[model samples]
Target: MKLLFVADPLASFKIAKDTTFAMMREAQQRGHALAVCTPQGLSWQQGLRVQARVQDIALTGQADDWFSAQPERLAALADFDAVLMRKDPPFDSEYFYATHLLEQAEREGARVFNRPRALRDHPEKLAVMEFPQLIGPTLVTRSSADIRAFHAQHQDIILKPLDGMGGMGIFRVKADGLNLGSIIETLNRDGAQSVMVQKFLPEIAQGDKRVLIIGGQAVPYCLARIPQGNEVRGNLAAGGLGVAQPLSARDQEIANAIGPVLQQRGLLLAGVDVIGGCVTEINVTSPTCFQEITQQTGCNVASLFADALEAAVRGA
Candidate 1:
């Protein structure tokens, strides 16, 4: 099968930890022809179909020189058997426009995983609100007063911007409300942008577990990213140490409840973040940890994803 990955620049990938690179490696090993295009390379003229300046890539085993790419050439997205939207997030206006292009490509018979509309519909932080039963006390608001009230009620809380990734712009306020006002100003931009406020889960010291779900099924192992000294965020990007462990019973329960819903929404791949027993976030855009989990647990995540992608393409 011919596969196209709409992702970040090949030159920018940290091959050692890049989940997209792992997926590409597995797909290549299975003899699938692979093409890659950055979001910027996608274009659509008024009368023409969506096309990308895609490079066909060959993976080298070397970590430093991971891939060799052929010269890029324009091709319609529909030319590929499946297109993986694996771009990392800030999910800004440009990302929104790119999704619109992919949605158009979908109409022209290009199979897109985690459907474009679904990606737009389920912003990572906001998506967890859909399953309130699984989450801790949470509030999405822009008003400083509202945040203050939530802080008063919850005592210890986490405040973060809705669009943040890699734990950027996250703030924790204890019962004393240290810098709460400033954090609200920073995160909400003084009532212009909505921010998420949740009651702090003390269990974060254990780890913030990332459970990967593929094709409506949960991978048995999860990557538990443990926050290091003096850090409250357990995101690997936030300097946390990742350890792979078998999913606990609560993890399985949460995955079982959310997996099928995600599948129905066309999110073929997802990462559900859990801290303690509370569901914290649902990561659909570029959910990672493939290398961390596989290396620690021997779980072959990339191979599983490739298998799922192949099945999805054939069925599509």
Candidate 2:
């Protein structure tokens, strides 16, 4: 299979931990041809199909200089057997526009994992609202009064922006509501943006678990990212310690309930964030932790992903 990964620059990847790098390595080992491009390389004109300026690459199996690339060339997205969208996000305007371009590529017979439309529909933070039964008390609003009221009810709450990734702009307000008004201003931009507020889950001390679902099935193990000292965010990017462990009963339950639905919506892969058994985020743009889970649990998450991707491409 000829796979084109629409991702960040190869130079930016920490191959040891990057999920996209893991997938590329697995695919390369399996003899699948590999190419890569950033979303910035995506282009479409009135008469031409959606195309990307892609560079064909070969993994060198070395630590420092891991990949060798040929000169870049423009190719229609449909020319590849599969196009993996592995871009990280704040889901800003450019990201939103990129999805539309990918959706156009889909119409032109491109096979895109975690379908472009699905990515647009499932904003990580907002996607959890679809399954209220699986999540804790959560509120989405731009109004300061509504946030204040929710804080009054929950006493301890977490405030975050809808488009934030890697635990950015997240804040916790206790019963005393320290900096509550300031946080609201920062997160909501004074009614210019919406904020997601959820009741604080103390089980976060146990870790924020990332349960990966591939091909509508739950991976047996999850990466529990435990918050370091004085940190409320348990994101690996936020200095959390990642511990791979078997999924708990509640974790499986949540995965079971959400996986099929997400798959049906065209999400070939998803990372469901569970804190204290409550679904907090449904990461579709680029769900990760493949290396962490695989290293500790010997689960080979990238192989599972390769299996699913091969099946998808063949079936497509």
lDDT of 2 by residue, 201-294 (tens): 9999999999999999999999999999999999999999999999999999998899899888889999999999899999998899999998
* Regions of candidate 1 where Cα sits further than 4 Å from its true position: none
Pairs that collide, model 2: none
Global fold similarity of model 1 (TM-score):
0.99
**Could you give candidate 1's per-residue lDDT for residues 252-282 as a string of tens digits?**
9999999999988899999999999999999
Q: Which stretches of candidate 2 lie over 4 Å from their true place?
A: none
- Candidate that scores best on lDDT: 2
Report the Cα RMSD per candidate. Answer: 0.8, 0.8
For candidate 1, the 10 contiguous residues with the lowest summed lDDT are 307-316
Cα deviation at 244, candidate 1, in Å, is 0.5
Displacement of the residue 133 alpha carbon in candidate 2, Å: 0.4
TM-score of each: 0.99, 0.98
